[model samples]
Target: MVLIVLGFIIFIAINVVVKNNPVAAKFAGAGRILALVFILLGISTACVKQIDAGEIGVKSLFGSIQNDIMGSGLHFINPLLDVKKLDVKTQNYTMSGVNDEGNKAGDDAIKVLTSDGLEVTIDLTVLYRVVGADAPRLLRETGEDYRDKIVRPITRTKIRDNAVYYQAVDLFGSKRDEFQQRIYKSIEDDF
Candidate 1:
């Protein structure tokens, strides 16, 4: 509506200028082009995605997240907002104690006993999906460097700190699964 009104006004101005001064009317065309760009950008930002079956969408307006979650099918929204698609599908990650070399990492799989008697090693795979509303926040806080900023330090800290509480056998032995869970939780919370 706003664009339509502005467009109509610009059209009238262009006609009046064309009738009076063709050169001035030509200059006004440049302003119309700029206005057209703004309108297109606004429309693009207000994009709507038809949610897939069993999926939900998160939306943000001018970077402020909206709580109105989107479910399947057509939805209406302001063009000044952004839409993010999120899969609500069930997913799982299969983990086994293994290193980069493909060998079964020992009980201390992720942690090795240091010369000073500290044991530590960390090997794990993660499965993750972004929360729709928080995607913009996540992007702003970490940008494209999220993995490094959020993942590595939390992981290293958890493994090292947890190792201090357990011996090499506990780190690498039957208790390995427990350790893995602890590390996963730590990183998940911190990240």
Candidate 2:
């Protein structure tokens, strides 16, 4: 906007203010060309957006989220729109028994009470990603901190909920697959 305004000011000063000066009249054409260049440069920069690989763009216009998303590439869009880039590549979150292994400094593994009243400590790693088509809604509803606010709490809760259905020994050996499948199904539905 500043560029466009400055361009117009230059054009007016060259053509109107200096029209009567014989010495300035010789350079008026060059000043006019420079003014047009500034106007074009501002418009081009404002309308073009580039999204990096493994990322998607969520566009919002005048603070309202748009339903559509932009994939990795250059896009021509409205000058007034704001774009937030989100990575679509696979992401991993871990809860581990060892300190420094999980996202937190302490032992972050899940502890749950089994049906037989035994305490079970489980180390879990969850892999997830954002879908391009839902990026706008996800951004609007969850914001950028979806990892802590949404993913972590929900995963821990669902695992604990499913753990009580099996004995501690079964969760570690025989019914381990079943327990994992049940937890996955519940979390998938909620997500």
Best by TM-score: 2
Per-prediction TM-score to the true structure, in the order listed: 0.49, 0.76
**Candidate 1 residues 116-161, lDDT tens each?**
4964555555555556556556655665455556654555566676
TM-score of 2: 0.76
Which residues of candidate 1, in runs, are more than 4 Å off? Answer: 1-47, 53-55, 86-119, 129-152, 184-191
In candidate 2, how many clashes are counted?
A: 0
Q: Give model 1 RMSD, 1 decimal.
A: 7.8
Clashing pairs in 2: none
Residue-wise C-alpha lDDT for candidate 2, range 1-191, written one tens digit per residue: 67878888888888985667878877888998999998888788879999999999999988889999998999999888889999999998999999989987799999999999999899999888988888888988989899998889999999999998998889989888988899989988887
Query: How does each model score on lDDT?
Result: 0.60, 0.90
Candidate 2 runs further than 4 Å off: 1-42
